[model samples]
Target chain A: MNLFKLAWKNITHNPLSLLLNMVLLTLGIGLISFILSVNTQLKDKFEKNLADIDLVIGAKGSPLQLILSSMYHIDAPTGNISIDEAKPFLREGHPLIKRSVPLSMGDSYKGYRIVGTDHSILELYDAKASEGRLWSNLLEVTIGSVVASNLDLGLGAKFQSSHGFNDDEDLEHEHGTFVVVGILEPTGSVIDQLILCNTESVWEVHDHHEEAESAEEEDHSHDDHEEHDHEHEHDHAGHEHSEYEHDNHDHRNDMSRSQLLEHGEKEITSILVQYTSKTNFQALSMPRNINENTDLQAASPAYEINRLYDMMGTGTRALQLIAVLIAIVSAISIFVSLLNSLKQRKYELSLMRVLGGKARTLLSLILLEGIIMSLLGFVLGILASQLSMAAMAGSLADRYNYEFSSWQWHGSEWYLLAASVGIGFQAAVLPALMAYNTDIHENLSDA
Target chain B: MLKTSEIRHSYKGTQRFTFPEIKCDESSSLMILGKSGVGKTTLLHILGGMFKPLSGDVSINGTSIYTLRGNNLDTFRGQNIGIVFQKPHFVQSLTAEENLMLAQKMAGNSVSTNTVHELLQQLNLDHKAKALSYKMSQGEQQRLSIARAIINKPGLILADEPTSALDDENCKKVVELLEDQSEQLKAALVIVTHDNRLKQYFKNHIELS
Candidate 1:
């Protein structure tokens, strides 16, 4: 007997129009919600992995590509730079530099990059071993949390490295087999998808291939050399044999830090630099100085990422505008349906007035119907968006090696709820006023 | 008792009407007869408290209804007077019984299922309690309309051409039902119609040319 029950009955009395309005509303709201969720997650991932690196110095190439390759590990490296040319920035305790971590890439295990770096990388990303211990030897390795779970690699698991960032059996490096010694905890950063080891391992694997190729050349031209050349070849083969035997006995016997640094001819892919004071004049001038005076290219990660966001913002803005337009269209649909029903219910409204019902009662009854329809559409729209996001999460993670969660609440959704209710109220106002002003004598007359 | 005095009305200051004074005592019936365009429906609207006369007063049970104004007038009219339209109309979404409950509720009275069931049984509509009001036969809809009007046990009942659309047999049956229900509540009854067939049923009559 209450207005709410009566409104509900009136809505249910005409099923086709109600269903039409609900479908349009659900589509419009769902699209808006889905876009908001994806935009939030993309911004979150990009900001989290920025990691406060002041500059990236690499071989001359695109500055954005340098940041993407060295920082996010999503693109190909520009090229390798000789360590001798990069030594001035890599030196310890330089006045202008706070810290620098050198990176040597060009290796992978099952599409997960094997990054060769120093212990400073672990501190840079605030990474800690969740199981076992961090790698302290040349051939040992530490795996990211995602790599461990996805490839099911645990402590003491052994795997050989491939020459590039793709899984190809032909490019497998048979001379090197890395043993996982630790698994890092998830940091929700780029580090969670990498396999980290010291710089010497990458050098050792490639150096062994070079020496083996030269030895085969010497065998084909044995007659051209003198007796001393034969002895020199035997001595080098014996030295390599002893090193191989020592690898199995004790991993700590591998090349020490000083010995690896003494080899000045080595090459590394990039160096990630942090400034002693970011606001200092020298730090601000450092990237430009390196780019102009030297052969190396220096790029600021924050600037590059901002450029990337600006490029992406246009597409998202267009999509958001389209979603809002659809929502407006849905409001118009609700208005038209309610207006039509009001026409059909003219006699019924007059009957209510004659039966001692106030004009305001009829007004509230129409308002209640509109609000109920909008609220139902709002709830269903949100559910549909979240469900679709969760369904797409698996493939997104596999493609980008980043996790996306749909359960997190966003503040914009509350605003969306308010907007939906406002639309409902706006649509109902005209029809409700019409019902309030119904002509009782004209409608109820026997003419 | 129901009474009116100096009842006069006009539409947009053009056509005008001056109705004769009317008075009906408890348990009595009065019929106002006129052809179309003679303001029979206008007089019914004024008597039912839906239209305010240009200059007139309608009093039911010693309370002047038109002078009450706004919601007070609406509440008074709902509690003291019942109206039956010429063409039977209802809130189409509600069932026959729910329509009765709604009338009682709108009149500031608690819904009494007992009274609703009793009225439905008396009007031979007990089997249609759950049926949608608009889906019923024309005769059944007419009976349901009467049930809604008197659900609050008003002191005055007004009918506007209540039987003009019915066959001779159904018209006779409807007139008997209205008289029987009005006598049971001991309310003053007024019927306005162009159908001369009802002239023989009421001794008290007024005609407008």
Candidate 2:
């Protein structure tokens, strides 16, 4: 009997048409909601991953991709800068710089990425293991929750890595098997998708593979390397071939351990640094200025991830505009249907007029119907958006190294709610006026 | 309270009918009996402020109805007149109570649920309050239409061929409902019909030749 009831009944006067209208609007709202939800998730995950590092220092290239591949488990490293060249920044006793966490990726264990870093990187990032402690030796590995779950990996488990993003890449490494020592919890951070281990571990297995290759070569023609002369010392079987003999061939004879590290002889992948204090940022001017200003490109992960989000701005806004445009179109449809009903409703209009309705009262009733339907539609739309976000979280998180939870309503979501209701009322006004201005006697007689 | 002065009108692209001047007030029932196409509808349209004549005017009390237009005309028409069309129209979407409630809203007056209940009781339609217009029998719908017409207590009741489609039993029931409702509202009643069977129900009769 109220204006809203009347308007709603009228909007749905033709049941199929009203359902068609709701379905169209629901889809429009659903698309915008999905984008908005993903945008929120992407921005949030990037910000969360950046929590471990104050900055990334590396070879000059795309800073965002560098962060994506190195800090997060997406993309490929932009090629390693020599540790000898990077040694000044990693100076163990530097007055201003704290310890750096080096990361080497591009190896995978059955599709899950393996990240090589020191145990200090785990402590520095506050990465608490879900099961045991961080990797203590070369072959030992500590992996992320998603990696463990997906690979069905546990402590004491061992696996071999192939090269690059897919299995088609090189599996020719001489050293392959890595033992899992620890597993991290699902923090919903990039760490959840990573397999973290020590830097020397990358070189150790590959070093063994090189030794085995030389041993097998000696068994054959053996002319490729002349110094690798193995006498028939087969008395101890697996222990008889000197492991130290092949290690000596590729390593430096003149350089000491510190000098070997300084000259890039002991290779590591990428380094993540945290400034001990704000003042320390100013003190590390040479490396910072060099990375940003010189041939090498070091980036603050926060800045570049935000830049990537900014790049996605146009696509998100366009989707939102399309959603609102369709909602407005739906509102217009409501108006058209109501006005059409007015002509055939003359006798009913005259009867209403005769019964006691004022012009303004009739107008209010007509307008109220549109508002009611829009409000209902708005409620339905928001529900659709929430569910869409949950569905996208898994695939996007796995592939893009990001996740979207419930969208925070204070930002763009508020605008969506307003646009729907405003469109509803805007559609109602014209039809209401038409109903109000109808000629009573002409209509009654015609009826 | 309802009266018409000397009024003249002609239809566009036609010249077949002329209407005689007639006035009916409260305390009387005016039945204008005639064959089809004698301008009874045109005269009804002029009296309800639905049309402006080529000459003369309609008045309520002493105020000219022709003075109102647009929503003002709508408001004046709703507050002063009750109309029952020949077909007894009702919005298909609304229930009987809702149709009556709409009439009350249109006159800018508050009619209580009790008022609607009591009016429905008088028309013997109280039991059918929740029925959709089309769901009710034709006789029931005609009664519900009458219930809707008087919800706002307009000063005049205009029913055009109210019983035209009914059988003898139902037509008598419809005329009785109309007569009883006009007396209850103190509305001057006017019924335009070609059927002479309705002459016995009205005190004042205007025949158009």
* Candidate 1 lDDT tens digits, B93-187: 89999999989888989989999999999889999999998789999999998998888888899999999999999999999989998998999
lDDT (10s digit) by residue, model 2, range B160-193:
8888899888888888878887887788888989
List, in the given order, the native-contact fraction of each candidate.
Answer: 0.67, 0.73
lDDT of residue B199 for candidate 2:
87
Q: Per the 3 Å backbone cut-off, how many clashing residue pairs does candidate 2 have? A: 15
Each model's backbone clash number: 0, 15
Which candidate number would show the highest lDDT if scored against the true structure?
1
lDDT of 2 at A207: 45
For candidate 2, the per-residue lDDT at A115 reads: 76
lDDT of 2 by residue, A116-230 (tens): 7666566555678879877765557889887888779988998787666554445645455788888987777777877876555565554455556667777887575343532
Q: Which of the numbered candidates is closest to the native, going by highest DockQ?
A: 1
- Using Cα atoms, each model's DockQ against the true complex is 0.65, 0.47
**lDDT of candidate 1 over A1-447, digit per residue (tens):** 888999999898999998988888888898899889988988888788778899999999999999999998888999988777888888887798988889999888888989988778877899999998887676789999999999999999999998878878887888889999999999989899999987767766655655554566777774545544645644554455446446634756434434445546667899999998999998999999999999999999999999888878888789888888888988998899989989889988887877778989988988888888888888888888899889888777665566789866788889889888888888899999999998887777743
